[model samples]
Target: MATEDLMRKALEALGEVNGPMSIEVIHRLVDAGDVEDPMSIAEVSDLLDVSAHTLRYYEKIGLVTVDRDSSGHRVYGPESVRRLVFLTRMRISGMAIRDLQHYVELVDAGEGTVPE
Candidate 1:
């Protein structure tokens, strides 16, 4: 196969992970275009079948922070993308929304909680 054709196939393998990342962090991951990072929101959505609004809500409630690009666009790095996958999986495991929020709060507080 030609080099160009191989590259094209590789990009195609990227699939929905390629563009339309719903969250900033996810976008950054996709933009980064490396396995070391997370894929874009579009990729995550395609991978997990979740809606963009769900991710937006996660950001709204401080569950996720998507860094912005110079153009004021959200950029998602590998960590954020990985976190998304984890959170999505947690939801699937019957984790309550409040628990998730608490977990996020602990993370925000540098892994310390107010104690039971």
Candidate 2:
């Protein structure tokens, strides 16, 4: 798929997710661009089909908070990206939110261990 077309699909995926977008959107966002750092909330949501509101809830309870952009939008750097991926996996595995928050705090603290 084309780059722009992919981005649109990503935006749709991470968006309200009111409905499903084409599978191409998932494909493109997953590998589009040379994003060295993690994606913004919008970007992650688009790529991962997550709701920013859910992400925000994670942040609210200290699940994640790498930083924010100049516009005060949640800015998830590369580390955040990796953590989100892990979080998503855990969620899929049926981990509870409280447990996820604790795991996130450990990551923010540079533990990078345990939860095994």
Candidate 3:
């Protein structure tokens, strides 16, 4: 899918939330299956409407994990792209960074947090 399209869907996914919603946005976007081949950092950055520095920051904070190519350039795979989209949507929804970190922590914890 095109970057713009991905971004649009990401924004759209936020509508399912009224307020203080859970992380269903991630599952919704991920299950949408917009996975394309792995994309470069610039490409994913442009798609997500974020800067490279911001992407690096996301990684630094463990909000996302981007794989590196042989040359060490960050390559965003499909899962990573989906995650970035979700994270972008969450940020746009005014979710606090710490809250997002907690959400990520919950997600990383897997099915146990589903009841949260």
Candidate 4:
């Protein structure tokens, strides 16, 4: 099945669940095998439905860390793509940039800060 189809079905399943859902649940639902290959900025932008400029801005603001290919173009790995997915979702849910930044900082600080 297509990734989009899988995501749609996953979302439908999620909607049926009651109570607070963790990010890991959503991650598993949306991951859908696209993480196996590294993608360019354009590919990530298209997959996440965000613009290249926004991706660049995210990177610039330290929200994500993307590697560069041999020719110096951005290459997003699985983890980076996963992070972007979470970031985009949070943005869609109305998270402010500063709050997102702080959240990322807490996340980067490690699992010990989970309560924060």
Per-model TM-score, in order, reads 0.59, 0.59, 0.71, 0.72
User: What's model 3's TM-score?
Assistant: 0.71
On lDDT, the leading prediction is 4
Per-residue alpha-carbon lDDT of model 4 for 1-116, expressed as tens digits?
A: 97656655655576723323334445543663367789999888767767899999999999999999999999999899988988988875559999999999999999999999
Cα displacement (angstroms), candidate 1, residue 66, comes to: 0.5
- How many clashing residue pairs appear in each of the predictions shown? 9, 4, 0, 0
> If ranked by lDDT, best first, what sequence of candidates would result?
4, 3, 2, 1
Candidate 2, TM-score vs. the true structure?
Answer: 0.59
How does candidate 4 fare on TM-score? 0.72
Clashing pairs in model 3, backbone N/Cα/C closer than 3 A? none
Worst 10 residues of 3 by lDDT: 16-25
For residues 33-59, what per-residue lDDT tens digits would candidate 3 score against the true structure?
486899988887666656899889989
Per-residue lDDT of candidate 2, residues 1-116 (tens digit): 98766656555666723444445534543454345765778888876567988778776777666687788777888766666666765674459988887666666667456654
Deviation from native of the Cα of residue 61 in model 4, angstroms:
0.4
Question: What shift in Å separates residue 48 of candidate 2 from its native position after superposition?
Answer: 1.4
lDDT of 4 at 80: 93
**What are the lDDT scores of the predictions, listed in order?**
0.64, 0.66, 0.76, 0.79
**Taking the tens digit of each residue's C-alpha lDDT, what string does model 1 give over 44-111?**
55555567788878888888888776776566676777677778756744598799988877876873
- Least well predicted 10-residue stretch by lDDT in candidate 2: 16-25
